[model samples]
Target chain A: MALDFTIIGYIAGTLTTFASLPQLIKSLKTKDMKGISPYFVMSFTTGLFLWLIYGLFRNDYPIIIFNIISLMFWIPLLYLSLMDNLKNKIKINIK
Target chain B: MALDFTIIGYIAGTLTTFASLPQLIKSLKTKDMKGISPYFVMSFTTGLFLWLIYGLFRNDYPIIIFNIISLMFWIPLLYLSLMDNLKNKIKINIK
Candidate 1:
């Protein structure tokens, strides 16, 4: 049987992109972003944004779709990370 | 000046793929995968494999390179999860 490679791309794209969700959920559940490194997230988000731009340039539907979904997940996590940092800063200032 | 989109792809690929390093290191340092979901890893691994296959079929070097690196981190993490589960099983059997 001939392999439909595009289907594989779709499945792979969805899995890798969505994998971040569990970590985001964990951070929310525990209200702890202690384990996640900001360096990784900042670099990862920048990379994803570039990928999204690339997708648009190529007009690749799957790339565009998946990259957008990834940004949706990552941006909020970044925001949470920022919020966490802000909280630390405020505590330090008060003390 | 015209933009070199390929460089953008490289940055994005490396960022997204290597983002797992911090998580992997955390697991190793703390010896805890309690926060990591096996379902996510399984699905993510499947996705990365397909992406690697797609890269090979398309002769896309960045895709191939990044996906392979991602698997490097993920496969070991998967093994750790399996080992953790096995240890849990042994504990139950002993009781």
Candidate 2:
């Protein structure tokens, strides 16, 4: 690949890493996972896992780096989602 | 690439595409775009565009297909976001 093309990949990866930040921020700020979909997050996280694996196999640093950031962004959301579910269950149990 | 590897790619793409569906649905249901981030969406969309282009350049069908579905999921969110912003602005202006 040309230097320019490689640079483009870097740019793309950077943009994607940044793109997921808002959801991360919102999830943090609101602590409300009500509307967020669990299935979607799981699937997206899985996809990122594959992307990370693919990056590793291909030895693509950009892919690896971007996915690392995405994982960081996603894990919290997933954890919060699970916690919300657990809390709801406890409420139901108490009721 | 091995057949197994190709299948993995297919599965990964399918999962990611499905993952984004819930957000699309929620965005549609609530029509609430307050928490969603425009910058993230813009950056993610740009990344998807590049992914599409990269897929085209490499003749990678999986990347292309996944991104198309992702685009479908994202564009509505983006539209809803813009519409909400406009609506809020109009309300403020009327006041």
DockQ for the candidates, in order: 0.52, 0.58
- Deviation from native of the Cα of residue B11 in model 2, angstroms: 2.2
Model 2 agreement with the true structure over A1-95: per-residue lDDT tens digits: 66656676667678777788887887788887776667777888898888777777667787788888999998887888788878888999999
State the lDDT of candidate 2 residue by residue for B1-95, as single tens digits: 65655566577678767787888898789876676666766788888788777777667787778888888888777788778878989999999
Off by over 4 Å in 1: A1-3, A85-95, B1-3, B81-95
Per-residue C-alpha lDDT of model 1 across residues B1-95, encoded as one tens digit per residue = 12666666667777888887876786667656554556666777878888999888877888899889989988887887677767878999999
**Per-prediction interface RMSD in Å:** 2.2, 2.0
Candidate that would win on TM-score: 2
* Candidate 2 deviant stretches above 4 angstroms: A89-95, B92-95
Residue pairs of candidate 1 with colliding backbone atoms: A12-B47
TM-score of each predicted structure versus truth: 0.79, 0.83
